[model samples]
Target chain A: MYRVALRMLLGDKTKCLGLVFGVAFSTLLVCQQMSIFFGLLGRASSVVNDVREADIWVMDPSVKTIDVPYPLRALELPRVRGVEGVAWAVPFFKATVQVRTHQGMLENAIILGIDDASLVGVPDAFVVGSIDDLAEPDAIAVNPAGFRLLFPGEELDVGRELELNDSRAKIVAIVDAAPAFAANLTIYTRYSLATQYTNNGRNQLSFILAKSADGTPPEVVAERIAARTGLKSVTSQQLRRESIMYVLANTGIPVSFGTVVILGAIIGVAIVGLTFNQFVMENIKQYAALKAIGVRNVKLLFMTLGQAAFVGVIGYGIGLGIAALFFSTVPKKSDALRGFYLLPEVAVGVAILAAVIVILSTLISMRRVLTVDPATVFRG
Target chain B: MTTATDTLAVRCTGIHKSFGEGEARVHVLRGTDFDARTGEMTFLVGPSGCGKTTLISVLGAILSCDDGEVDVLGHDLRALSSGKLADFRLANLGFIFQQFNLLPALSATENASIPLVARGESVKAAETSAREMLESLGMGDQVHKMPAQLSGGQQQRVAIARALVHSPRILICDEPTASLDAATGNTVMGLLRDAALAGDRSVIIVTHDNRIFDFADRIHHMADGVITHIESPDSSREDAP
Candidate 1:
């Protein structure tokens, strides 16, 4: 009977394809939009994620997100280091500065200043030169994406010269860093050199990156520092979440992406419901004949559900495949789309949503089949 | 212990059925009495809206009569719940429709195998039996052809095969030949009579086509929701009210 039901669905190629297209279109829209949404959230905290060695981040009390940071006084570093369970604390400087490329092109670049003595906040991976080379005179490391932006047609190599805030700076390495939300070039240099370049007021500390003494959880140490120093202190994970939450609270991204997701679901239900109802209506006489010939309503229900399941699976598979192909290829070719890919959790969520769409449509159509008078078969 | 009437395939008495309510109510079947014997073909013949179809629907257990003692193959149909009635139909009854009602997606063999499949037989085994039945009806080469590919007579033959596939105890047909030409109609009636009248099986046909009247052992004439009279091919007509 299930086989017969599937044959009935597949018999009308046009209608079957229409149903598949409806589900597939819904899936593609939901998955692609959700991937981009999550990817954007990830980029919001990309700076914090890149500095893997820091377990706790100490910032000014007013700071809410990494992108919009309020610099702390330089003395906040020693204060955080004096707190209990603090092994060491390093001064980290972050400020956006204007850069003049060797080609005389002016662009905005974010400068991350790590400790001059330890270089503890630099990204661990490098594409061109070694991390030790940051010790060179006026040395800095540029992320690969930033390097491409600064050099355009040039291959990745160190020893490029650029002007930062009217001061000469030399790129000693090409670092691998997560793409930033602002889509700006990222430059890493020593804290002292960065302070010299930026020349902000004496309060130049962006954040204090701290490591908890062994066996002490970062969350506990973070609470201690905040209580003692009257500053905002949070674990690295907490900061990442805060960063994403700040974007959600302050930006229009959620409303924009949320509207598309809702529209996708509505369109899916409408398409599947109407198309399935029409398919059932067109074959109503045959269903009545089956009913008259002794098919129980339960059996008819199974047949309809089986048809819905078939279309749901095929449509979801095709849609997910297309979404995966987009994530796999598009991000590689486009710089702005970097770090965006389909998440497994998002895929699973979309699948459950697709099932709901199919089942809801099938139930609506089944009402007609279940109530059809078998006596109608006798009338004609 | 069974008497002659006890062995009858279907028996109905004072069957009352109506549609609508209040002033719009219309009585479709009123005090209708009908019976068919085993191993014989019974025809219910009447003009349109004369209650022939309603009487057969009651006998087939596809519709409930407002008031009646309805029995088929020794089981009282009015005593059965809807689920049990469906079970009884699946186990003991078969139906043929005017439209053939062959699923256009399935081949002739698959269409003919529905009864057996509905009765819990494996599809493979059901199709094997259906293939033999279709072949016996001289449709061996067209077993795999879809319904649209077959002629009207051939489609009716497949319908007949479907009706008899599970070897049902009672076979009910509604205008089985209404869509066919005279020659094709006669040919289909011949196949139904030959293939369905074996083995204590009762075949009841509700049709308006007089050309196939000679194929029935008994013809029950209905008018205004009641059986007016009964006629036998071997004897003169008998009047019953």
Candidate 2:
């Protein structure tokens, strides 16, 4: 009888495909949008990810996210390093500045000042020149994608020059880094050069990136630093989550993406509900025949639900494959979407939503089958 | 009134049923009494809307009467709970329809195996038994062929195979050969008659086909929701002049 259910569902190719297409469409819409939304949230914390060597970050108490960092006193850097369990600490500077392209087009660029000695806060890899080239006079590293954003359709070069704060700055290498949530072009420079380029007043340190000693948790060291210095300190992971939470609470991203996800669910219900109802109606006689053959109502109900589940799984598999392919392919064409990916949790969430859709629609379709009078089989 | 007896495969008394409501209400069956003896093929012959179909449905326990006593094979249907009644039907009764209502998506053997499947038999075992039954009915080479690939006669034979696969003591057939040609209809009735006389089993068929009445052990005539006459084929031929 289970085999019977499958054959009945597959018997009508056109209606079967219609059901599959409806489910796949909704799954694609929901899953793909969720992936992009999570991708944006990941970008919100790219700064935290870029400073991977640091296990904790110390900042002014008022700073809520990397995007809105308030500078701490330069003396606080050593104070953080002076805390017990602190392995090493380094001063990092972040500030938004305007840059003038060779074409005279001005755009906002985010300048990240890594420590002069260890280069602790720069990107992980360089696509062109090595990281040592940043030691040259007025030299900075630009992300390949950020470079494209600043000079679209231009080849990557080792010595492209841009004017920042009315001072000459040369891009000596292309770094591979994720774009920030704000989509600002990124420039990596030495801390002392960044101070001269940005013209900051005294106490120019925006954050102090720190590492915990071996065998000590970063959260423990962060707590000690916060208790001693009267400044905000958090583990790298906590800071990343805080950044994401800040955007979630302050921006309209949740409402916007949430509305689309709900719409996807509604579309799934409408398509599966109507077509499955119609399919049951068309197969009413067969159901009556089964009932007359002494098949219990519960058995009939299971058969209907089994058909819906098959459609749901097949549709979800196809939708997830398409979403993964979309994430892989679409970002290559646009510089702004370089590091998007589908998360495992988002896939599980979309699968749950699809199951809800199938179960809800199956209940609606089974109502008629449940109340069916087996005597109807005699009418003809 | 017919008392419960081991010789009777089905017995019903004062069966009542109606359809629709208010001004559209229809009294489809009015105190109809029916029975089919074991080891006999009983035919119900009636005009349209005469309630023969409703009477057989009550006997098969597919539909309950408004008020009646329905005893099939020794179990009082009204005394059994609904679930028990369904189980009783699965264990004791087989049904065939006029249109050869085989599921088109299933192969001939799969369609024949439905009764056994509903009876909780494993599918592999059920299809194996169904294949043996079909082979006995001269459908050996057609086991895996779908319904559309078979002739009308072969489809009806597969339906008969399904009805007999579970070895039920009683079979209810509604217009079993109504969709077949004259020769095919004769062939199907022959199969039903053989099934009835094989081992003290009973076959009750509600049909209007007169060409096959010679195959019945007894015939009941109905009109306007009540049985009007009963006839044996010998007496039917004696009164033919």
Best of the candidates, DockQ: 1
lDDT score, residue B18, model 1? Answer: 97
lDDT of 2 by residue, B18-77 (tens): 988999999988888787888888889999989988898888888788887888888888
Candidate 1 docking classification: medium
Question: Which model scores highest in lDDT?
Answer: 1
Lowest lDDT block of 10, candidate 2 chain B: B232-241
| CAPRI tier for the interface of model 2 | medium
For B57-89, candidate 1 gives per-residue lDDT tens digits of 889989998998998988999999988888888
Could you give candidate 2's per-residue lDDT for residues A1-380 as a string of tens digits? 77789998998777788788878988899988898888889989998898879989999999899899887788898888899999999999999888888898788888989999998988778889988998999999988877887888889888889999999999999988788887558889999988888988887899999999999999999999999999999999999999999999999999999999999999999998899999999999889888888888889999999999999999888888898888888988777667887889988999999999989999998999998888888888
How many residue-pair clashes does candidate 1 contain? 0
RMSD of 2: 3.6
